[model samples]
Target: MINRKILARVAGVGAAATVAMGLFSTGAANADTFVPLPGGEIVKTLSDGTVVTVRLVGESANINPSLGSTPVHRNAWVSGSAQVELSGTGADSGGRIFPGYTVGCQVNIAGGGTSGGVDGGVAWEDGSPSIGASGGGDLSLGPGQAQSFYILDLEQADDFGSETHKKRNVFSGSNGSVTWADSTIGLSGCGGYAQARAFVSVEVETESVVTWITLYGQPFSIG
Candidate 1:
């Protein structure tokens, strides 16, 4: 389980910045930075009928820097959907970014089986490790099948108000076929309070079952 008391202290720029710092540290396996491609496009529309054009900046971790709109919230979580597009030889290179915090995600691969999972626990940088799994059994991947694992994102809008980095105690399982190809990972949220950022980088490493990983969406800090 996540320690809410510790999360309460992960606040402000120092605390929030930790979110980015921890993910991109050089110590981790295949450590790399999230960089955006040039001439990219991003369009975000809110439930209130508000739309904004996000300018392309440096892209990293599959998350686009151009999607710089205030996160909408759902039940106190950042809400809203931002259309993300990556076009170039590097599209399949790195992982993608979501925006603020990743509440949920799905993965699909064309012409291949799917196998992926998300666990909730303090990231390697946080010093503590916790497993965030929604299902009781280990997620499986069969040949030529596509599977998706959905986990409740630990980062919430209310979490922003708290001081410490917000790490939730819940996690989802990965379900899909097993194969090698350029796959897609996506994160979706609702409500004005929920915020998530996605990043894509080729440098990150994953389980052996994953032949190649593409970061469809990852989140980062803006404030």
Candidate 2:
């Protein structure tokens, strides 16, 4: 979560039950598995001599796989950090960072998933992908489907001075980062296997150009 208050937010009703089962169960059937992922790195130099680097670090997931009592449910706690750096003449300018994950149900999300975009397809208002899913990770999907959700729900005042929630963070001065731990991912309604992949999309703005760069993390099994 971008906001400290939002960290470790509940994935769904199943999270509590899953945690309890992991505590009391002794057999491998209910044991939790911890996976350490090799976070990735990407660098791109904008034609204007602006160098941008994005890295996904400290990535991991603790999966309960199943509730054991239900074949349609899976639970996991995920953690990671998204870091960005900018250099060259435009480094001083600011940009927005949006970090989230795409969870698929028997759908191959590699290289950006199916035609329109992952499950439910990518939402683009003006030819740019906008990850604006506000609903939490408690998802329902069928085979060959997928969905995306952001890890941040920042609370702040809008132009009218009323409370509003923002999914991205604004940063400046050549560097910015967002980290989250124990973020819950609860799934339901897919009788088959499921998988999830992390994504960090950053909007970089220099004097002459505004570009979006997205980096995808390795996908992992939910069961």
Candidate 3:
């Protein structure tokens, strides 16, 4: 009778251990809930009556947790592709008009606070290690500000044509992957949450007219 009671207790402990392991597995699966960002598309009509459509597709990010910490640091890799299509009566006829424009995409990371004891972190290019920049200045966010970094830029100047009629050129490109790393004083403060976003810009030019349009993508967390 003593031996049988001991065996029963051991079996009960084993069953409880199995249930605990199963719960831990379920929690871990739920923690990795970051999904792909939704792509964006927009159409705009320029002053010259030209209609341009811009699409941002295949957007994704890989976020890694802090790598231990004195100054806590986190990393992320972002990638996506963009395309521009031109169609309108005002498009230059028989000439390469689209190639004269400039197309680009930028990523923005923002978080933290200043006076409220919140710590706004700084982000830099992953491999190149350059601090982000915008409007010809260093990019850093404090409280409500955001810093923008270029993902890709393409110029269509070499594709110009001599045709006197309406010219249309379609521009499309991909930003394979750009890595970004963020550093904070420590992760224990009020400004712990960080987000990443993407945007596309286009500059359209004619001999006498110029127009600009920009589209923004949804924001995703990096933590």
Candidate 4:
């Protein structure tokens, strides 16, 4: 659950900008920074006349710059909500929501603009870690590097009744939404300034087209 007391003290930005929510002294060298992010939204009209809208809301993060007693380690707790709405004749089977984040070390991950832009700036050139995504944020990185991970790992029975895991949520009708709170984003091995951002990738199916649309959130500093 999000602490409404802290949330009330801060207002939603509604735009992508570096924020400093609060500064609380935890120790002589370990001060925590809470960031209230202004999530974003995008709306597009497909060729088939179907309109799709994706939004990232209620986003925030708490950062601890030196988690491992060294300059190379950092930790953060993040939360947000992704909402998708479809209109017009399409939306046959609703959509799929894949919410994830990308962390970078001395790299650029900012999009061209706030909303309606699809580029997320994720893929690494070399040496990436397999996060299993499943809500695990522990990562080892070097300068000029970055990685991506999904936040959900849902368990469900397959057709044969075998348990399986999924990284996305599927919705029916014309609306789909997912909310996550206090997800961890851990990093190490980069003694320089680091940054992270959130993305909402949704696949909506219609009578004439099946397309994937991504909504980019504001990139913020991790340390």
Estimated TM-score for each candidate: 0.20, 0.81, 0.48, 0.77
| lDDT (Cα) of model 3 | 0.34
Sorted on lDDT, best first, the list reads: 2, 4, 3, 1
Per-residue error (Å), model 2, residue 184:
0.9
What is the C-alpha lDDT profile of model 1 across 39-135, one tens digit per residue? 2233323232222222223333323212323232111111222222222222222222222222321211111112322332212222111223333
lDDT of each: 0.22, 0.66, 0.34, 0.65
Clashing pairs in 3: 92-166, 92-167, 93-165, 93-166, 93-167, 94-165, 94-166, 99-156
Q: Summarize candidate 3's per-residue lDDT along 9-47 as a digit string, tens digits.
A: 000000000000000000111122434667566676655
Q: For candidate 2, give the lDDT.
A: 0.66
lDDT of 4: 0.65
**Best candidate (score: TM-score):** 2
Cα displacement (Å) at residue 122, model 1 = 28
Residue 119 Cα positional deviation in candidate 3, in Å, after optimal superposition: 15
lDDT tens readout by residue for model 4, 89-195: 67445777777777778776563232312122343221122333333477777887777787776779999999998777777777768888788888899878787
Of the two candidates 2 and 4, the one with more favorable lDDT, higher being better, is: 2
| RMSD, every candidate, angstroms | 20.4, 9.7, 21.6, 8.4
